[model samples]
Target: MLSTNSTAVAEFQRKSAQAQAALEKVRGRGTAGNGATSAMVDAGGRLRDLTFAPTAAKWGDRIPALVLKASRAAEQDAIAQVQKITKPLTDDPRLRQTLAETKSLLSAEEPGKRRPRPKAEESEDAYFRNFSPHDPR
Candidate 1:
């Protein structure tokens, strides 16, 4: 019985190391602004590159927004790959605590994966309604 448990633990460790190595190789590519803006990020959500195509000239005033959009897209891509790497490990009942620890190491949330926010568009009583349409409060 002891040997069986020990072997299982060793196998789990091997798979964990393999997954970590695979995660290190992940490079997420994303583009936005009609493909004029591009970004790449590593599995840890660090920006690796940013570039703008010649077509970006038409977006002179909006270039900053394009950059932000592209970066977020790249980060989301990295996060997705990280999730894929960790999925099998997380499914193991004995590894639940490790999953929580892994969540802390991630720099960005997976876009569109967060819980729905309370609707700020749903106004309060007319007398109490504020002017901000986007405010979560």
Candidate 2:
């Protein structure tokens, strides 16, 4: 019979290998304003590739801004990929912890990444409330 520690170790190793394989398959893609520039990153948040439209080359000094935009987009993409990959592992506590760590690492460093507030017409309560007109029997 295997010792408890050995069994645990074996399980951990198996899960780790599975995680690595899942990560290899996960990828993110980001695009700048109107696709002037774009970037792709792996689940580990490492840039895999980048592309720029012809108009992007016109901005010499603005390259930094464009790159930052692309990087932010790439980070968003990675988070989405991580979310999808973690959904199936949600039942495993250890795997959930790993996914939390991965999410922290993949968060965007740039400002204004937060989604804009919804307009007045988009209120959730407004949509969910029942509208009853006056009725006389």
Q: Against the hidden reference, what TM-scores do the models get? A: 0.65, 0.51
User: Across residues 1-137, which tens digit of lDDT does each residue of candidate 2 receive?
Assistant: 23644554566667667766888887788887578888888887888888889888777788778778897789788888777766654556555555566576677455647656677745865654644465332
CA error at residue 16 for candidate 1, angstroms:
1.2
Candidate 2, residue 99: the lDDT equals 54
Q: For candidate 1, lDDT tens digit of each residue in 66-108?
A: 9899999999989898888988877775455444455655736
Cα lDDT over the full model 1: 0.81
Error of 2 at 18 (Å): 4.9
Clashing pairs in 2: none
